[model samples]
Target chain A: MTFVIQLMSGLAVGCIYGLVAIGFSMIYRAMGLVNFAQADIMMIGAFLGYAILVAAPGIPFWLAIIGAMLGAALLGFVIERVAIRPSVARRADQVYLVLLTLGIGIVLSNGARLIWGADPVVYPTGLTHQTLTLAGYPLPAVYLYIAVVMPALLVGLHLFFTRTWLGLALRAAADDPDTAATMGVRPALATSVSFALASAIGAAAGVLYAPISYVSFDMGVIGVKAFAAAVVGTLGSIPGAVLGGFIIGLGETFGGQLIATEYQDSIAFAIMIGILLLKPTGLLSGARR
Target chain B: MESKSPAALALTGIEAGYVAGVPVLSGVDLEVREGEVVTLLGRNGAGKSTAIRVICGLLKPNAGRVELHGERIDGLEPAAIVGRGIAVVPEGRRVFGSLSVEENLLMGGFAHRRGIAPKLDLDAIYTSFPRLVERRTQLAGTLSGGEQQMVAMGRALMAKPRVLLLDEPSMGLAPMLIDAVFDMISTLAGKGLTILLVEQNASEALDVADRAYVLERGRIRREGPAERLLSDPEIRASYLGVG
Candidate 1:
């Protein structure tokens, strides 16, 4: 029973990492951008959700998720247009773009600090703190929420990318921007949409993660682990991101159980390095250049 | 034999190149009238592809005026040009390899429409290239070279373009595949589609074209009825490899 509880708990955390990693992989695929600010976007999303809850007092959790996603998407689009597009239009080097994203990340976190103050904030809901016992073992209710939500998100994303014209256009644009333009897909629009979508996903991850932990400006540090997950799954592969997330999440959980709890973070990196050294292209890498 | 139709697509005084002051196409003028197949015949590096790129808005001309059906379309983005119905099957068959063949066709019709159910357009493409029917769900990158070429052409056709530009349609194909490609071109022409074909296969191109232009070192060296160019001893020796 304890083992099963640990498994579910690991998977729940993995879902959060997977969500954030998807944003990383997607932006990388669409614009060849690393988007270091994605984690900060996630941080902003959590704050947005918290603000919405404070404003409304008792709105449903799902509504808060939607609000955060929309707010983050708008921010992401504006950031892409204002800060990123100029450098892109100039055909700046990849190193310069990476630095630009790093600067933006700093701006976002610091700006967030100015608005929300330095202290961490907690949700007012007591339901998230409730613990459920299954077979004489106590499990966090957030894990159950994650279990249901992750599958739903996966299905939604799968249908979106496979069955929608806009989704197909995004993939096409990422694959070959020049040919996609000839097919009537505006490259600028595609990049903007990609940024918006990635930021929304990042925000969703933040919302999902907030119930399990305190919402703070520095919580974006988790984004480093998610980055490790993206690299473990291959940089631009979607399914790989999810798989990488599970591996890191479960690995750390078991590693902490077997080894020392303090070494959990290092364990994630150890697994990532071991996997990269062996596969180089990641576990489920698609024809990535 | 000229039909006296107005120009469906026209390029006037186009001067363009990849690098500044090293123009690939210098003041080149060409036109494709409605329901006509106009072939641009030249050797590799003779600015044939460069002209096609300018027409499709992939490359902005240093100085030029591109017109479609009497309306100027120069300085527009490539997507805007595609929206205006000028579709190009670029030099290489640059298909979105990660996307399925059907998805690729759907992308071609992206200029003006929404929703996933553009069934009529997909049906037309599948009807034209029946081989694509079975492979619709397969990733484009997994296809053979000849099949990838078909997807590229079909993708452009999905736009229902007013004037189609084909650049090196016969490139990197087997002899038999090249013949099939030319036959498809001839078939499309018979359907009253206006076409601007760029080809190194001068003999085959001239056979299907109403008129032909021979571009030499960024200039129109010769242009006339396709039949006249086909019979020219100099053209036969230079491009047709016979006299």
Candidate 2:
């Protein structure tokens, strides 16, 4: 019964990491640069949702989620245009871009602190605390929602990439920006759309996570764990991101349960190093070069 | 030839290069009329690919003008140039290796607007390259060299390009595959597609083109009908490697 409970809790956390990792993977694939600010973006979304909830009491939880996603998407557009585009146009080195994104992350995190203050805020427990007994074990309703929502989002994303014209254009841009341009697909526009989509998904993860973990200014570090998950899954594969997130989540949970709870974070990093040494391509197959 | 408009693609005084001040091609002029095949013949360093790059708008000319159907497209981006009905099967068969053969063909149609009439049919592409139909789901990188070239050509055709720019379609192919590629080009031209082919394989290029130009040091040294160029004593001795 304890094991089942642990697994359920681990799965919920893993799904959130998977969502954030997918955003990192998408942006990296499209632009060939990791958006280090992704976690800060997720934090911004959570804070935005909190603000909306406070500004207008009695707003439905689902509506808050949608509003947060749209807000994050708009924020993503602005960040891409103002922060990323200039550096890219100059053809800066990869290390420079990485540093730029790290700077952006710091700015966003501090900006969130300025607006929302440096204290943790509790989100209303809306259907998340409700418990259901399965196999004579108590399971949180939020776990079921997380499991269902993550898989559904993955399926929808898969269909979008496979069936939609815009998704096809994004994939083409990722494959070869030069050839994609020749195919009449503007690489810049495709990149903007990729960032927007990734941000919205990250915001969705934020909304789901808020009720589980109280929203705070320092919530962005969770995104670092998501990055570790991305690396475990390989850098760019969507399925790999999800699998890596789940594996990391389980590892953390079990490590805390069996070993010292203080070292749970270390377990994820150790697994990441092990995977990098053993199978750098990740568990899921990804594009070579 | 029947009475028709001027060349589907025409470039006049095209000077373009990578470096800001150093020009790779100086005053390079080329043309491809409707239903005609033209070849640009040159050695490795002779600016053959640069001419194609400039025509396709991949590299903007430092000083020249390009006209497609009489509309100037000298400073336009590559996507805009493609939207003007020209497609290049770029050098090295640069197919999207990560995508499947079918996905690659579908990407070729990205330029067509949402409500516009479909220009190219998938069935036609599959019929043109039957092997592609058999392996539509396979990743493009997994294909053999000849098969990859077929995908590259099929992808260009899917765009329904009025003028096709083929750069060294014969490079790295076996003798049999080279013959197959030439046959495909002839078939496309027979179907009314204008073609500007750039190649180091002078004999094969001359055999397939209606007109030929020999480029040396970024300038056209000779221009004439393919047969005349092929039979010219100077051309035969210096370029054709025929006594």
For every model shown, the clashing-pair count is 0, 0
Worst 10 residues of 1 chain A by lDDT: A280-289
lDDT of 2 by residue, A22-130 (tens): 9999999999989899988898888888887777787877778789989999999889999999999999999999999999999998998898889988775455467
Q: After superposing candidate 2 on the true structure, give the runs of residues whose Cα lies further than 4 Å from its correct spot.
A: A286-289, B1-5, B113-120
- Model 1 Cα lDDT, one tens digit per residue, A78-121: 99999999999999999999999989999999999999999999
lDDT of each: 0.89, 0.86
DockQ of 1: 0.69
Docking class of 2: medium
Which numbered prediction scores highest in lDDT against the true structure?
Answer: 1
Question: What TM-score does model 1 achieve against the real structure?
Answer: 0.96
Q: What's model 2's overall lDDT?
A: 0.86
